[model samples]
Structures are given as structure tokens and as C-alpha cells.
Target: MASEPGFLPRDGLDRLIEVLRRDGREVIGPRVRDGAIVYAPIATAADLPTGVRDAQSPGAYALNAASSAERQFAWANGPQALKPLVFSPRERLWTSWHAPANGLHFGAAAHTTRPTAVIGVRACDLAALDLQDRHFLREPYADPAYRARRESLFLVAVHCTHPADTCFCVSTGDGPEAAKGFDLALHEIDAGFVVTSGSNAGAEVLASLPLAVPAEAQRDEARAGVAAAAAAQTRRLPARDLRPALLARIEDPHWQVVAERCLSCGNCTAVCPTCFCNAEIEEPVSDGSVSEHFRQWDSCFTAGHSRLHGIVVRADTLARYRQWLIHKLATWHDQYGRSGCVGCGRCIAWCPVGIDLTAEVAVLCDDGEGVAP
Candidate 1:
């Protein structure tokens, strides 16, 4: 059974970690590392990025230490999201060997998965996870490896109280507050966390924690914080459904302008949680007796991505950039019934040359042609 909203004091966080670990789940959370906040194995509440806030803008990201020690999830988000956890960046698919007596032999690759409990998950990440699940675990062709990892996971979401300038999850209707797809959700307040369970497993875990009914004041503060976070965002897509307008601008002059600045380095796709392009590669042994097939993350920005019959379809940066933009904003709606962007703003913050997709959409849809109201 799901439990009512409750309050867990600051010290209770450590106990939560202990309980998850005792349940045989490896707890992963945000931590300050390499001058930026990144997710890693966390043992206690002390391992969280306490009093640390991130400053993010187009093409830039930096972490600053705040004066207060009470807030742990004070920042909006980091470059990494839940994509890599379920859809691995690289994994072996299968291996083949040749024997003189047996001719050829093939063996499926073993996928090892461990039960994981991740803390500090954001609403945007949960939304992205849903999209990935649709792509990988949908229909009759579900990916076996992704399914194994996905099933062995537990999600703990944190409501966003501090949004970066690039954030626009409110416009996408995916964030500021977690609405679904979490086992447990938390709103970090000054004194402690206002926690709620969304699943029976989360309720069982909450029962183990020392919790108290959240005061009216704490609940009001949490609501106000999320509202303030929503109001603080300065960037937004021109419309929630950008399919018609974007598809119509396939030959627009703006493609040239964007391509001039785009390095075709694939950084945006790499950091984007919803972008799931990958390439299969074959690795051969020294004796040529064994060959291993591996699947690794790929991006449309690469020169070889659109190659066909020794011909590069998207030969230049303009076509490549246009393909990426159109696919992410337009064609994805045809395939997934929604835009690929989750409004996490990682593509905007992690781009080396500061390309803002929201700004691009505004310019492309400036005439208000075919834009949804």
C-alpha cells in the first residue's frame, strides 16, 4: 500500500540508504565530482552533494558551493541522466568463433544486472525513462538486455525546486514536480524531506524509516518552491507540439546559420537522455578465430551515420543538423506520439558552442505557421 505524505528528518536520510543497501540494492545518487555534479555509488547522506548548486547556461556548466548545509538536491540537473543506466553506452551483443572440426560456433553475450536504487532522480529523467521504455520495451521486439536492467531498478525521484535558465520542463509538462513513474518521490525542505510513496515497495521502505506527518507549513513550502521553480525558467519551446512547423521548415535558411556554429561533435545527442542512436561493431581476435559483436552509442551528427552504398546521404553539417532537429522535434511525434525532448536542457547546457534548441524553435516558428496554440 502507498503511504501518505510524511516527513523524514535530516538524519533519516542515512537510514534510508542503509535500508536500501540492506535490501541488496546498490544506491546511486548525485555527488560532487570532477568540478561537476555526477551520479555515483553513495553509501550515506553525507555522500550527497550537500550545499552545492549548479550554474548552467547555453554551452556552459559550473558547480558552486552554497552557504547552507541543509539542502542536498538544491541544483536542477547534471549532464548525465537515467539513460545510460538502463540503455548501456556500450555492451557486447554476441560472439562467434570458428573451429576446424565444428565449423562455426556462436554464443549470445551474457548481460549481468544488479538491483539498483537511485536517489535524487529528477522529474525530467523519469519522463525520459518512459520514452526509452517505449522504444526498447514496446511491441513484440523488446530488447532482452534493456529489459533485464530495467526490471532490476528502483526509482527515487526528487522534485525540482531550482531550475536553470535553460530548463523548460514546465512547458513540456514533465517537471518541477514529479507526477508519476517513481517508486518514491521527495521534496527537499530546509529541516528535512517531505517524502511520499508511489509503489508498494516504496511504502515498505517508508515503513522502515522513522517518519512523521509533514506539517502544513512544510507542505506549503514545497508547493511554493516548485511553483517558484516553474516561474524561474526563462526558456520554452514555441509550442508543445512542434511537428507541423518544424517539418515545414526543412528548407528554411536557419539551417545554414545553425550548421555554421554546430561542430557536428555529437555532444548534445550524447548528453540527451532520450536520444538512443547506436552502432553495432565487430571486434576480431588476433588469430581471426573469434569475433565479438558489440553495440555502442552513436549519434546522427557523425559523418558515417547516414552513409548508404558508399555514399554519404547527409554529406554536410547542414543536412546532419537538420536531420537531428527535425527528427527530435517533428518526426519523433509521428513515432512516439510526442516530442523527443524532455525539457531537461542538457543539450543546451552541454553544447560546446551554445546552441539553444528552444531559441531555434522560436525563430523557426516566428511566423506562427502551423504552430499549435
Candidate 2:
């Protein structure tokens, strides 16, 4: 029946990397760089950040050497998510040229991308992927480029047994455990990893590796680890769906309070896993022959984002902040059938003012109660 999950010795991770590479996929994993954990190209298992930990709080992030050698992928998500890889924050779309003899010539830019096997994916990001798929693929006008990249991805989600304080995936119904949207889900423990395959691709990789059927006791330990993590979380969005209340309070005074602290730097949208806004621009070559069209990420906080016939709809920071929060928590559900937030807490952690969304929502709704982590 293939119901039993398998086990991989801690050292067998190298073999897993080799299997993916042999399948012609580049491996990307979190590595310690520039004083924080960031996703980068990895070859061998040694490239992964071992004995590393990070402390993340509102408006702050710090990385340090882990005291325990067993905690390699224990840290929370880095600045990057699957969005940049698939949706692409900035990318060349096409090019145009003017020929002296002719009127103009347009050349469709050939975009080349690699198939990737992303390791250390957590549950929240997986839920974000679901949102992105709906936004980029299921829409009437599908993004072919995003679809190509998304289709080529081989996901390996890591069950987060060590969530950060910024994480609120539990409230968002996203994480602490990755039950879906993965080729494989791994639970890392002292001796090794308890692994489960969710797809044929994952099964093929599992079949190639040297693995053992996990004992019932080992499986229980893995379950306990994830449960303990869920218990350790201190922050969460309240279960009372904020969408209805948030939508009704668009003009609430709380917007002005948060706007006062907000720099409007767009850090929240930039770090948000579900924020997929982008702007297209054209750049002319110095020689005046070729013009390149590019797509770059944009934010609603920007003044020009809401421009309407030379007049900005959201002229003030208050309006902009209101638009962002409302879209994220309320209107996004009406548009996408789900909240725009996956509760990764990147927005809270990266915001310059440390403006926690939960705190802001609580203030607006005047509801102090939240789901206990």
C-alpha cells in the first residue's frame, strides 16, 4: 500500500541531493550568508547551513551560530520565497528594435529557466504556492512564464518543528505541519529524518535512496516534535475570520495610527508570500536601436500604484495602508477565495516599524482575543 513513511540517515541527504541533480534539477536550500539565512544554489549537503539559528522579531532579524549541531533547517523562512523563482520579481519580457530601413522590429525575448528541486520548504510557503498558482495559472490570462517555472518545480517541504516567533501559520491554517503541496515532506530528528512521499516523483527519489521504514516509536517522536513547535508559538491570528470585520472597518481610525509609523517602504508587500503585484517598464538602449521591456515588482504603498488619470486614488499613507491591509485580509478572499496572507510573518518581521498585522487588526476590530499558539 506504500502507507509507511521511510527514514533517511542524516548523512543520506547528500544522496538525495545527488538524485535530484541526476534528474537534471538544481538544488536550492537555505544557507548562511551576509549574516542571515537565505536561499542559494547548493550542490552537496555541506552547502546547507548547519549549526545555524536565527532570531526574528518585528522589524528585526539576526543570525547566529546554533548551539546545537542537530538544528540545520530549524530556522524560519528567509527573505526569499518561491515567488521570486516562479513569478519573478524582475525579468526581461521582450525587446523591440528600430531598423533604419524599416519601421520597427519586435523580438520576443527568449526566457531560459532551470528546473529546481527546492529543499527546506515549509508549510506556510506551500499554502502561498496554492495562492500563487491560482493567481498566475488558474486566471483567465495565465502567465506562461510563471506556469513554466511552477511546473518545473519539484517541491520538498520541511515540516517546521521549530517555528519562529514571527510565524502565525497555525492561525492561518497553513503550517507547523506540511500535509500537502509537496513532492516529499520531511521531519528532521536527532538520528535522521522521517520522510514521506506525496507524489510519484517523490516516490521515485525515495526508491533510489537508502532508506528504512520508520518504526512506530520514531514516527511518534517526529509527530511530537512538530506538536511541540506548534505549542511554542506565541503569536497567532484569531480564528474569528477577520475578513468580514476588516472589510467593514475600511475607514477605521486605526489605519491612521499604523500609517503614522509606516514608512511606506513596501517592505510588507515585498516580504509577503502572496503579494504578486508587478509593473512593466521599457528601457531604451544607449545606441538607440534596441528597447527592452521588463517586469519589476511594485507595491501598493507606492503613490503611483493607485494613479488614476493623473490623480492618485490613494493619495495619502492612510489610504494606502488601508488598501494594503484590507486587500490582504479581507478583499483577497473575495478575489481569490482565501486570505492573501499565509502567516509566514515575513511582513511583520521585515516591516521597518514592526507593525504587526494581528496587532493592527486587533486595534481596528477592538478584539484582544487571538488563537493561542
Which regions of candidate 1 are displaced past 4 Å? Answer: 367-373
**What TM-score does prediction 1 earn?**
0.97
lDDT of 1 at 197: 93
Worst 10 residues of 2 by lDDT: 364-373
Backbone clashes, each candidate: 0, 0
lDDT of 2 at 342: 87
lDDT of 2 at 315: 91
Candidate 2, 94-150: lDDT as tens digits: 899998898799887676778899999989999998999998887689888898899
Candidate lDDT (C-alpha), each: 0.90, 0.85
Q: After superposition, how far is residue 177 of candidate 2 from its true place, in Å?
A: 0.6
In candidate 1, list every pair of residues with a backbone clash: none
Whole-model lDDT, model 2: 0.85
Worst 10 residues of 1 by lDDT: 364-373
lDDT of 1 by residue, 36-64 (tens): 88889998899999999899998999988
